[model samples]
Target: LTIVCIVGGGPAGFYTAQHLVKTRPDVQVDIYERLPVPFGLVRFGVAPDHPEVKNVMNTFTQTAQHARCSFHGNVSVGKDVTVQELQEAYHAVVLSYGAEGNRTLGVPGEDLAGVHSAKDFVGWYNGLPTNRDLRPDLRCETAVILGQGNVALDVARILLSPVDILKNTDITQPALDTLAESSVRRVLIVGRRGPLQLACTIKELREMVNLPGTRPEMEASDFECIAKMLKVLPRPRKRLTELLLKVAVETPEETELERRNSAKRAWGFRFFRSPVEILPSDDLTRAAGIRLAVNRLEGEGEDVWAVTTGEVEDVECGLVISSIGYKSLPIDPAVPFDPRKHIIPNTMGRVQKCAGLYCSGWVKRGPTGVIATTMNDSFDTARTLLHDMDEGTLDISTVKPGSAGVTTILEKRGVKPVLFSDWEKIDSEESKRGEGRGKPREKLLDVGEMLKVAWT
Candidate 1:
């Protein structure tokens, strides 16, 4: 029997295992995750209000429960075990550990009290154990988010959505309580490019436009030349641009106008502006505002780049969340990592200069695309691995003790691996707790509590 090991229990890992087990009946796959509970971003990164996007978890659950596959949680690969060690126990090792590092704005005052990365901010509300104590002060009147992606929109919607709307979601109790007392009335989503080059999809933009009790405060000038160029763009880009035009340029009908006029909260897009520095509050401890450098597009269409016009603008805001992007961190000194790209250097998911090693998802390519994109990417990697095996590139002739060997190593180190059954126990407890609170699930935001429940 051929044994394969996959690091990380996120979508990439699950999808790769699903393909391998279904395609090759003799292949046994084991997934190792750092967290006691499985489902990394699906459980931690997805916004509470967007539960529909998280339905992918059901598919992941099916993969984990497969007879030929196994899940080992609470096992930190680089720490509890090394990449080189897993290679010895399994015929092949696939690294699907999704990006966990966040890119910084690289500006002054970024270290201020009110400045937070969207990765941690999202984690705080989604019940990621590490960020449970991110007690962000929502007492300010305005918040500045530096990015124009779907994540940036998710953050804005969560901040401005009515408490009644969010009460039913899986948002943490602490986040819900803080949001209830929030004084924030406006949010500015700043981007370096024009509307034509927006990174967000139409669905996210539509939600913002239709967000209850909130009105769009877009600048009319931002969409001046956008309409004339819409017909020549791709269908998706054209549709997205049309929506932006409707929100920023076109006048709404009477009923819609009334809704806009009566909105209690507001959000706007600040296009062609790049963050230069985070302005500090008096006493110089916390973020008071942000200084933005005005930018102009250098090229036409979606291939445009932002060039600073040397004009500066300052907006007063209490909180700043940078949704720039997520980067993958190096797992171990043994693996090859491209620090500049923040990804494992690989071709077609095959790790460069390393035999029997592969990678997929964000760690293979830079962090981009949606869940569907990740699915296709992971399947490609699985196909490549199978191709290598059939072509005699991967030696599966020798009998290797997969999890049994890893278990022995882990036992000596005193690290208890949480098996799939153990995770179900924790899952059951979280669901039972959520039932009391009228949510789908109230996650255990403490590793110790998760392990206690898992082992119980």
Candidate 2:
């Protein structure tokens, strides 16, 4: 039997495992997750209210329960067992550890109390233990998000969403409480380019437009040349552009009237602005505002780039969330990583010059695309591994020990791997707890608490 070890229990890892198991009857797969829980981003990055996206978790759960598959959670790859160690024990090693690091804006005053990365903020509300203590101060009336991605819109919607609406979701109790007390009423989502260059999709944008008791604030000039180019763009981009134009231009009179009457909450887009620095308060301890350098588009369509106009403007707000993007982290010294691309050096899922080793998802490519894209990428990697095995390029003739060998090594090191059944126990407890609060499930945000519950 060929023993395959996949690092990371995210969508990429699970999808790869699923494809491998379905294709090869003689293959046994073991998934290693650093967290006690499985479903990486689905559990900690997706918005609470967007339960539809989390539906993918049901499919992942099915993969984990496969008879030929095994899940080893709370197992840190680099610390507990190195990549070389796994490669030796298994016939093949696949690195699907999705990007855990967030790209930072290299600007002054970024370390201020009110500034946070969208990754951390999302983790905080979604019950990731690492960010449980991120007690962001939402006492200010205005909040500024420094990107136009779906993540930026998620933050905006969460901040402006009604407390009653959030209470029904599986959002952390602490986060729900803090949001209920949030004084923020206005959110300004700023980007370096115009509406045509927005990173968010139409689904999220439409949700923002229809958010209850909230109004959209857009500058009419932002959509000046948008309509003329709408017919020339692709279907998705054209539809998105048309929506923006309708919101910013077609309904100007109605929107103005709604803005005058609606006093609940408001959000707006500030285009052609790039962050120069996060302004500090009088005492220099917290963020008071942000300094932005105005920008202009240099070209048309998708090739457009932002050019600084040399004019700086300051927008007063106490909170700033940077939703720039995510980057992959170097797994171990044994694995080859391209620091420049922030990905494992791979060609068609095969690690460059490294036989019997592969990578997929964000670690194979940069952080972009939706779930469908990741699933397809992972499937390709699994196919590559299978091709190598069929062609005798990967030698599995030496009868490897598989999970039993790794279990003995882990036992000697005093590491307790959480099994799929063990996670089910934790999952059950979380669901029971959520029942008391009328939500889906209230996650245990501490590792100790999670293990204790699982062990119980």
Clash number for every model?
0, 0
Q: Compared with the true structure, what per-residue lDDT tens digits does model 1 show for residues 286-355?
A: 9999999999999866678999999999999999999999999998999999999999999999999999
Q: What TM-score would each prediction reach against the true structure? A: 0.99, 0.98
Q: Write the per-residue lDDT of candidate 2 for residues 62-89, one digit (tens) a residue.
A: 9899999999999999999988889889
* Residue 423, model 2, lDDT: 98
lDDT of model 2 at position 311 = 99
Best by lDDT: 1
Error of 1 at 106 (Å): 0.6
lDDT of candidates 1 onward, in order: 0.94, 0.93
